[model samples]
Target: MVVLKMKTISLKVNGITKEITVEDNELLLNVLREKLGITSVKAACWRGECGLCTVLLDGIPVKSCMTLAVETDGKEVITAEGLYSDERAKKLMESFVKHGAMQCGFCTPAFVVTSHYVLTKNPEVDGEELKKELNGVICRCGTYYQIYEAVKDAEKYYKKETKS
Candidate 1:
């Protein structure tokens, strides 16, 4: 008889503390979407080439599919759902919609997450610098210009929001 070993991981997901038991080999993407029902973290391009599984791990953008579930133990994670609660993120979403940055909607969440990370880290980044910063996220719909514009506008709005 073979006994499978399981690890219990407790991590904060979208401002909520969640404890889940997972196999040693299980990926964070699976646990998030399957166990916790956080579908915003997509498993597209399991090899991490697509950047569709991007999420904020300890306030830093990371690919969920490539991270092991056990590695997230006692860590902080924020998905698109969590971002929605932030004022700056809401403004960013509005900017994306206004600029038509999303088409198929499959990659919007990842882009939004990345944009929030970039803008929060460097509020003044613009032009080619902004593009290079967000190069990790890939939108198959060819909405780069729209995404850039939205991010640019969002940076301004976010700055304004923080001022008040």
Candidate 2:
């Protein structure tokens, strides 16, 4: 008989710290979406190809579907909901709406989070690099042009942070 081990882990999500027990082999995507009820972390293409479940792990973007819940213990995981207080993220979201970057909205959160990471790292990221960086996330709605425009429009907000 095989029994899965339950492990207790503490992870900070969207600035809130949560301590929960999870099966040893549970995926971080399940932990965030199922246990924590973070619906923004969508579950699609479980193999991590879709990037719909991307989350920031200690300020770096990672595919939660490919990450183990246990590995997030004591780490900070930021989803779209968590970026509310961030000016850059806020601007990016606004731009997304204004530019009509999302359609159907399933992949919006992941694009926002990943785009936030890209802009945070380099507000002046060029078109090719931006495309390469966002290649992981797939949008079936084919709003790539609009998404690009939104990110570009929000570049000023991200740049403002660097100057300050």
The candidate maximizing TM-score is 2
Off by over 4 Å in 2: 1-3
Cα lDDT tens digits, model 1, 98-126, are 99998898999999999899888878886
TM-score: model 2 vs. ground truth: 0.96
Candidate 1 error regions (>4 Å)? 1-3, 161-164
lDDT, model 2, position 84: 88
Candidate 1: worst 10 consecutive residues by lDDT? 155-164
Q: Model 2 lDDT vs. the true structure?
A: 0.93
Q: Estimate each model's TM-score.
A: 0.94, 0.96
Model 1: per-residue Cα lDDT at residue 109: 90
lDDT by residue (48-159, candidate 2, tens digit) is: 8999999999999999999999998999999999998997799899999999998899999999999999999999999999999999999999999999999999999999
TM-score, prediction 1: 0.94
